[model samples]
Target: MDHQGVPSDALDPASPDPAQWPVGRLLSSAARRVERDWNAHLATWDLNHASHAVLAHLLRSPMSQRELATASSVTEQTMSRVLTRMERSGYVTRAPHDDDRRRHVITITDAGRSAFFVASDRELAASMVTRGLTPEQAEQLRRLLVVVAGERGPEDDPDLSAGSAG
Candidate 1:
């Protein structure tokens, strides 16, 4: 038993006979581990997955706070908090919309783009999640995860419907 009083490998996907574990345990544990590692990697740029997504979106074009929130699938309040941190880091700037005083447009800065590009290093990010799998197995896992994620998510979301490209 681990410190939590549960068998250490009970939720480990790499464990022998992990197939016997409940799907919820396996998925949650795996997600937690991967997120932890990914967060650590992103820390070098003082960014996280959420910030990365924001940078990605802004890279395409500047958008209002509400629009960013909607695109990010987060609430306006949540997006405000993220923007606040980003603003502090000089990664993004907020300015009043010309047409609407209540709306603030978000634009990524040069630093943000630089951080996003380096932090978006595909090889490092891919390895963090697919460390144990062969290239073919990793591809299969990505497809499977897309299916799982798409199951109950907004079907029209481009991020989901676009499908993985090699």
Candidate 2:
């Protein structure tokens, strides 16, 4: 048994060697581990995966909360809660749209931009999760994941908003 009281074999019972693991199991395990580690690191910055998504999406440009929720793959209510926290932290501001009084736009504050960039570097880097993989291998993994995730191209993904390009 290990320090956590889990049997040594149980620690990786699904596959003693990763090479022997099924693709589904391997992918699921890798994703869970990466998300756990990423979330832990993000907590140090007073953020989480969800908030990081919001900031990442906003990095492109200001957009309405509803649009942000869609782009971030979060519910509107959840996005509202996140925005409330971000606004309270001075990381974002919500203002009524000039032409659409019923609509509000979210803008990342200067502080938000700084926090996003800092956290973004750590959040987006695969190095934390792909510790043993070479750069070429990492690239190959990215390509494979894209296919498995059903992404045809960046244009098809709102999360990869083109507004950031310019």
Candidate 3:
């Protein structure tokens, strides 16, 4: 309600609890909360979200910085910083491509694979987001959030990304 005793969707910045926030604010803050909690969990393995992402990609196959940046939907400059950090942590290595010395391929090290295996625990991650919800409720929440996010990329629809033979 506003000063005039009318309903309002606007958020009160002074509020300490998110339950008092607007829907949009609630959603955005909740996402940040989940990310923060997840990062804290990943810290045990000495890996954060961005570094873990690079490791996951390298686990499949070594890729040039350009390829990784594209796959991760980030810029080469950003990917370079991430690679540098991961390299110093002994999670990944960057070496010049044989065919093209201008391009450096990034590969996950043994330590990276081990950390990824442990840090990428599905149940642990899921619980961070779905805690207190029943399995069915969590599944419903997942579907609702996806729908509310509106846009769907090719990966969201397997039939579209992977052609189905008629």
**lDDT (10s digit) by residue, model 2, range 12-76:** 53657886555568888899898888888787777878888888888899999999999988899
Which residue pairs clash within candidate 1? none
Can you tell me which runs of candidate 1 are displaced by over 4 Å?
Answer: 1-19, 152-166
Which stretches of candidate 3 lie above 4 Å from their native place? 1-17, 148-166
Stretches of candidate 2 off by over 4 Å are 1-21, 122-124, 151-166
Against the hidden reference, what TM-scores do the models get? 0.78, 0.72, 0.78
lDDT value for model 2:
0.80
Please write out the lDDT profile of model 3 over residues 1-166, one tens digit for every residue: 8753547755565589876676678888889999899999989987888888888888899999999999998999999898888898899988889998888888889999999998999999999999999998898778667756767754675544464332
lDDT of each: 0.85, 0.80, 0.84
Score candidate 1 by TM-score against the native: 0.78
